[model samples]
Target: MPVPAPPAALDDSPSARRREQRGWYFYDWANSAFYTTIISVFLGPYLIPVAKTASCAQDFPGMASDRCVADFDKLVAANPGLGYVDVLGADIRPVAYFGLITTVAVLLQIVFLPIVGALADHTGRKKELLGGFAYVGALAAMALFFVEGDRYLLGGVLFIVANLAYGSSVVVYDSFLPQISSPQERDDVSSRGWAIGYLGGGLLLALNLVLYLQHESLGLTESMAVRICMMSAGLWWATFTIIPLLRLRNRPVPAHETTALRSVGGSFRQLGRTLADLRRFPLTLLFLVAYLVYNDGVQTVIGNSAAFASEALKLEQEVQIIAILMVQFVAFFGALALGRLARNFGTKRTVLASLVVWTAIVVAALFVAEGQALQFFLMAFVIAIVLGGTQALSRSLFSQVIPKGREAEYFSLLQISDKGSAFIGSLTVTIALQLTNSYRIAIVSMVIFFVIGFVLLALTNLPKAIRAAGNEVPDRI
Candidate 1:
């Protein structure tokens, strides 16, 4: 297929760029509903119960006639090896299914995102690709509403599709950072995007929380209410994505390169070249490593905090929900506040400072007594303060070092580091849990990731990295 030239760039006036930035922010708003509602609040809790039902039927055939009436906890406790569904003769634990599916999605992205980025850079269809992936992901997420009874396998498949699309859309979206904003404006722009995303995601989550809490009064089954909330995220994602699709403009790829590297096969070859080219930018590569390590710690904490609250702290489900809501709302202001800090203190220093806070938070987790809701909330509050800032700054900083004309390709690699490292922290926690039989020790062990990442990041010379990538260094960076 012939790769057509992209549409002209948006007007270069300050107002025009501001308009583009506003539109770009909406993509963050649109997609975050998926992260907050489905991934963060609902899916694991909902899907695991569904998987448990399937596992009950498969492992305890007697319960099949009763619709799996056995108490899941008691059954698992008694059997110690129950609640597993066979996947091609492999016993897959019900609780592990979500992580398994997530791992699969990340692995797929690792293999394919670079190609997607290469294609976007070559064809300059970033806006189209962003909208396409967002809508596809929304549809996949919406399909979760139908995951009734023992449809855990169906849920897994849909989640993989949704997650893969979500990650791809984000790569394309982040590529727009360098395109739409000058180096000086990136920190503020990226932070605003994250802030708005928090507000959007938090608003939906608040509504969902109400729906979930009052399901009985609302004449809806708890499962059905959860399903509706999940579906609503998809609807919200699809609805808001239209803003960016309408407002964002695509920059044309150079004519000679567009004609020469138009094919999917050609994009793959370009990806190969990009991989080989990474050696030319060691500082950029080192920053990615630093990000991968620290961000893994961040992701692990976010991913496992609920489990920690439930298992180690013995917090109620309601308390956990409230804490998550706090994080969501507080993070909105936190992102903006951090952006301003980055403006004054520099993005690298601000992120490093956030890492220090993260390490402190994990350490503090060790001191929260079991069943102490207030103490747990205090820790969560601290986490919320730094969560958005660290991630937003990291995104903006990475944008600085990416090679010109290869924004999408490099951001694709960043996306890999972003999504691909969660398992590492999880594994570390798992190992710690196995050895110590203490969730506190396991949670605290994540401090290592932050320490290592902070050390590496502190050593990285940002101006050098930027210049090494043949890009101009921003004054603050």
Candidate 2:
């Protein structure tokens, strides 16, 4: 595929670039509701109870026989707290299922996102592609409203589809960063977009949490309230997406044939070449390695926090929801604060500092015994401080070193590395939970990834990588 010409308006003026940037930021706002409410806070906990019901119904067919509905209700009433499900005579925990589902999704994205990224690089209708994928995911998320009472299969399938769409759309969305911002401007621009995403996600989570807290007053059952809260994330994602869909424009590209099969082949070839070319830039590859390892820990921590709170800490669902909301809102400021930290101390140092904090958080988490909601909240607050900073700076810093005219392709690798790491992280947590039957031990296992990433990051030569990519290194680094 031929590299597209940069738009004169976007390339020439700061004001025009800034205007385009605002539009770009909205895409983060558009998708984060799904991440915040559906994935991070509600779905894991919700699915556990639902799946438990299903598993119990299967085991005790007597309960689900003639009076199926009533029996199931009776069972739930009898055993209010269902811990593990017996599947084929083996015990399966909810956290294990959650980890398995997410790992599968990440694996799927490993194959799927590169194709989307290549298409973004080759095609001109990026706006259409972004909106199309976003809505597909949103629709799947909306379907979660119906996943009640042992519909674990439905929940799993919908999450895989939604997460695939979410990750694919992100590839296209991230491809726009290099197009919208110059090298020097990328750190702040990326940080601002991340900040906006946290704010949008937090706003929706807060409202949903309120609805959940007041469900009885609103004449709704707790189950119905949870369903509505999950559904609203989809609505929020779909509704907020209109701004970016309308406002962001695709740049002119030299058109190329992108038939289904042709695009597939092209993506594989692009991926192979990119992989081979990495040998020429060792620092960039090292960074990818570092990111893959540490980010696995990050993704695992975020994805499983609610489950950990419920299963390990024995915290109420309300407390978990409120804690996640706190993370989202606080992360909004954390992104900006980290950006300034990067300015003062360099991006690499700021990120390193955040990693150190992550290590501390994990260590502290191991000591947070069951029912210690206050300890969990305090630990969550510290995590919020570093979450946005680590991610935003990582994106901006990586953007600095990728070769020109191949932003989409390289960022696709970053996405793959991210999801790939998640697969490992999720699997590790699941195995730890299964073997040790303790969340604290599972949580502590994540520290190895950070330690490995931190050591590798310390060895990375950012200045050399920047120069090799034919871009000047930011003085701040």
Candidate 3:
């Protein structure tokens, strides 16, 4: 295939753009609630106290087994490196307890996402997987209402399930971008999805924030308010998700006449063949490597920043919520602006710019210390600026390199690749914090991933990949 004239192939008509944007937006709106409610704002903070109590059974089983805190107290009295305990004097750290639960969840996704990708392509059950995972994740989130005291273990269990669903569903949702849009138009479509997701996640988080801060004022206990927020997120995920399933057309799965076991076996075998395509799909491979590294940094920020701020800097909960609220809206517009930039300057340039901004933010973070709410809040705006832009543009750029009809499967492998990179950022934070006991330094170190990703991304042959993928057209020289 010859290099495509992206302008002509993109179908820049208002009608085409509108349809692509709408679908993209709806999907984001449906999924953002999980990131906002369960992973970031609500669950982590709420789980901290409970995990301390639960960890006693495992961490100090010889002493704390009876009342859950007896041995914990003894260990503390003996001054045994017990910093993991909370203000109420309860265990959470070496375990990263909640993180451990979700780490297991991501591992499930690393294996499961790729298989589901193959299944979605072979079976044409893309939306089914999307809807199914959305509800399952939601239900697991709602069940979080039951997590209390020693129930932290249960919370961990539910988190694994909920996150697994969320991860699996995203693979399919991301895959749909390339399938539904022409090669050139995918960025616009992907951007709309990201913008809408940010808005949706923001909206629910905003309401949940109000509910959280004013639980007693609203005639609800803090625990109940937390539960209600968790439940609402699930319902929100379930309800809004129906829109795409109803409106979108389903493509039938490939009609390969093979046994089910053999078909499954073949997808695994073909994994190696897919690797071969990587060398040919140079930009796609480079972009994947870039995304793997940068997204690790991004996910680390999203997943751990609040905890770092709260635990290390000793930030008030209200301040964190407000900053997160600001991030949501800022991200919504940031994604929109970045998407427009991609349309004008191409995906690589725009995404690289976002990465540059992220590098600056992390570098600036090194100087932010103590309970500097005002400083962190200011930094939050910078975070919001690049947050949506990098993710949306990366998705769109990768979408251009993928062929049609393999969205779910390809994106599944992409998700797996992405999750695999997370270990790097997670390890970076862990090693730094363990060695230096410095969350501040750990937070600053993530910037290296962003900088390196941006430089590597600049060198990728994206135009060549587009041409090889049969997505390119002739130039009108």
Candidate 4:
């Protein structure tokens, strides 16, 4: 099969652009419910705690037996080498203890996403792969409604499974950028998608919150609220995703005659091929490493920030939930505004500026120990401002630079760099919390990722790769 040129003026009509843009943004909205309502706000903090009921008074903070505290004392005393911080804290939940699991999943993502991305490129199955994951994941997330009591195992299982789908679906969706966007318009489209996504995600999250609050009022256990939130996220994802699944059409590529299984096999091969071809695209590969590291940090914060605060800061669940809700709406316009800022200042500068804000946020958080609700709320707002913009610009910027004739394949690698490394971030924070008993240290740790990523991104030579990747630069990737 011959390599094809980038897509040319394909679906460039204003009406067509409007449809695609909305379709892309809607996916964000659909997925946002899970991230916002479940991961960020409710599940990790509220659900995890609710899920950690003890059989005896020995479990909860104050009631832990004198013996248990003595045991902790003896363990530390015996191993004078063992620091107080190293001892498993009273506040951290035991059931949610397998913090390492998320890291394992992330590592798996790094290994597989690019291969699938390459396969999507060769087989033109981006839409199928993405939709397949979305529906399957939606179902898995919906099943979480049944999770109750010590069903932490069930919840963890479903999170890993559904998150796998979420991770893969994003690769397919993001790969479409180089197909539908002109270089000039990619930032706008990415930003608009992100902004609308926040709105979409926020709307669903708000609705789900209402359902969750009323779960008991409607005669259900508090745990059932989790079930309702989970189901709504899935249902929201499934319904909203149909727009893109129906409207998105892949760019032309060589006709690869192969069965779906065979195509998957070919996907693995293409991954190797992309890596072997890496010598020809230095800037892209360099940028990938930077993104992989920093994005790992970003993903970690998004996934576990609330959990860390709730556990370490001893924050109220209601306060955490409200803060999360605030970020969703703030992110909506922040994405839009940041994209425009990028247009004026360039993607690199805008991204760098965002990193600076993230760094300061870490510093601020480190100083805020008690009665810092306003400070914490402000931090959440800052996250809203930078989160969407950073991700949106990063995607579109990379779209502007990837090699030609392998958009899906290259973009898949990009996804690995972004979402695949999320586990690394989560684990880092969790482990830091485990080590230092300080959410501040964990928050401070993330700054290094952003700083290093910014430095490397500054050093990346994008325009040259834009040329090396060739005439297709303005067309499809």
Top candidate on TM-score is: 1
Model 1 Cα RMSD, 1 decimal = 2.9
Q: Show model 4 residue runs off by greater than 4 Å.
A: 1-14, 54-98, 417-421, 471-477
At residue 434, give the lDDT of candidate 4: 60
lDDT of each: 0.84, 0.83, 0.73, 0.71
Task: Output the lDDT of residue 336, model 4.
Answer: 89
What TM-score does prediction 2 earn? 0.91
lDDT, candidate 2, residue 176?
80
Ranking by lDDT: 1, 2, 3, 4
lDDT of 1: 0.84
Best by lDDT, which number?
1
The residue-by-residue lDDT of candidate 4 on 1-477, one tens digit each, is: 566556554657878867776676777778767667666766676444333433113333454433443254333345444322111233443323435446655667767677768777888767788888899889988988877654555766777777777777888888887677668788888888878878877887777767666776788766676677778888999998888888787666666655878777777777888888888778888878877777877777777767766765667666677777788899988998898788677787888788888778776767766656777788888889999999888888788777666877777777765633376576776678666656667777888888888789888877776776673343322
Residue 287 in candidate 2, Cα distance off native in Å: 0.5
Clashes of each: 0, 0, 8, 1
Tens digit of lDDT per residue, candidate 1, span 422-443? 6577667655654454668877
TM-score of 4: 0.87
The segments of candidate 2 whose C-alpha lies over 4 angstroms from its true place after superposition are: 1-11, 62-92, 258-260, 417-421
Clashing pairs in 4: 7-476
Candidate 1 collision pairs: none
Q: Give the range of the ten consecutive residues with the poorest summed lDDT in model 2.
A: 64-73
